[model samples]
Target: MSILNPLFEAVAWVIMRIHAWLSVPFGASSGWAWGLSIVILVMLMRLVMVPLFVKQVRSQRKMQAHMPQLQELRKRYKGDKQRLNEETMKFYKENGINPLGGCLPLVAQLPVFWALFNVLRAISDWQPGTTPKYGLTIPVVQSAKDARIFGASLADKFLFPLPHQTLESRLVILAFVLVSAATTYLTMRQSQKRGMMQQGPVDPDNPAANMQKYMMYIAPFFALSGLYWQFGLVIYWVTTNVWTLGQQH
Candidate 1:
């Protein structure tokens, strides 16, 4: 009945396996190993989703191509909301396009995102000699608790600094926050710019355009919000954002 339990167990097993494999090369400093394992997890997830991403890109292009027709439909049915909806659906059907396809990638990622969160939370909350259904051993959990990247514990958050947080931890947290925000903003800005270039600049008063502009600005705030997440998750996020930027390019 609990989705989180199963997802957490699956993700934890994969993470622990990755950590174990990497530990051979990087022993006591397995914090970096764990951090990089998250990066690899992101890469693996993205790779698996590549086909869907392609569909999303193609859907956007098709939608952009039909923008003029859609506008015409809107004007033609300005007097009848029901007719407009019917016509829009008919048009999409005829074109072999699903307008909602653009959202598939984001929607699909939510479960995996939560799974990753649960896995990290489980590790952070682990008690001595206690092992969950996930394959992570007691020693693994202990090592994860002590895992540090650039002298900052992987479990520490920028907003909730550890009592003995050092200067290095603060600096590293700052760096991660800035990079995450910058990457998010840049990626969204680039997409907006491309859309503008293709669509000849969105009208400032257009409701849809206004919404897109708002999203462009508001979405980057997630990076600030992510400051509540563990530093390891932050590293995963930065890596994912960087990969997204490259993919978008």
Candidate 2:
């Protein structure tokens, strides 16, 4: 009944298709098949998002380039707030500069992230004897539950692995969460440094500034999320963070 149901179905369908194609070559139970499917899915999504990212970057660079003119306008209209607002609107209209450009890509990305997480969660929640909703087949469910990378089931969580999973697999899950969390923190740090350099100072109470600060402190602790996230979802998070890091460079 929810509008998001379609998006969730689309995400599951894409993952299912990718896994089917990969399973043929790597074998249905092979972790490589599922892992590669997830990796490839991220690449595909990011590829589609590239144009939006490019546009955002271009818009930011353009704004930076025109800072001097904006400063001049501010100076000219210092005492006249109404005129300043009108002139700002005119400037934006003439220059085709969209103040909201930076938000479009981020906004577009949220649903994709959410849907992917849901699909992965559904698979991870499926154990050998359990069934998943969303029309996932028996073979699909079996393969996902059985798939193992480095002795660790993609369905395994770091904090509370199923009793059937081995200690070695538990260790691997721990490592995946730790590594993924570290990588994410590093990526965010890089972004924060870059943004600070580009945007200069801002008010302490600004939501964006506060968020940057909040995430900086919490980024390392993000590994705790592994308590709930499946190893497969960890793969998605780490891969996407790595992709974002590369883009920043």
Candidate 3:
């Protein structure tokens, strides 16, 4: 029903095809195959955005280089917000810098995340023997319905445990949530450390510095919202966060 439904369907199709291909060589359970497909999907998505990530790094470095000038501008135009905005834009243009460059890659990835979320939600809600409107084939959906990993279905979630709701499922889901939250926090801390190394020590009073500080908490809080998300999606999140951890390290 949403405008993004078509994109979600396309992403789901790709995931299902990849899972089918991987299943041929890996005689693992269907749940594991589906989980691997999600991991691969995240890797592929990140790979495609490598150039944008590079651009983000460059932009951040440029901002770091201009920090002194930016601070002076803030001091000089402390009261005139309109003039400050104009001067900031001019400064960025003169330096060939994009203020939003670091944000662009993150913004671009949002749709992909949303698409995956919907695709996994569809799988999570599918009943055995029912036809899925997107993603896997009828047989695959049936397999998914019966699939369980460590007694927890890939489609299960803390907010909506499957019909079984066994102790093992509860433990697995809890572990996934904790790991996801921890990785997210680590990623933010790592990014902040790198920024400090490049930009010098941040002055806590600066608005930009304060915003970055706030972001440390905000990102992890958002990650925790995945407690309600499907385990399949949690797998994707955990894998992606791990990739980021390795990449940043």
* Model 1, span 14-40: residue lDDT tens: 887888888889884566787788888
Estimate, for each residue in 7-53, the C-alpha lDDT of model 2 and write its tens digit: 98887888889999998889999999988888998889989999999
Top candidate on TM-score is 3
Ranking by TM-score: 3, 1, 2
Listed in order, each prediction's TM-score against the native is 0.89, 0.74, 0.90
Sorted by lDDT, highest first, which candidate order results?
1, 3, 2
Better of 1 and 3 by TM-score: 3
Question: Where is model 1 poorest over a 10-residue stretch in terms of lDDT?
Answer: 127-136
Each prediction's number of clashing residue pairs:
0, 0, 0
116 Cα displacement, candidate 2 (Å): 2.6
Per-residue lDDT of model 3, residues 103-137, tens digit only = 87678777888888777677667766677866467
Model 3 TM-score (2 dp): 0.90
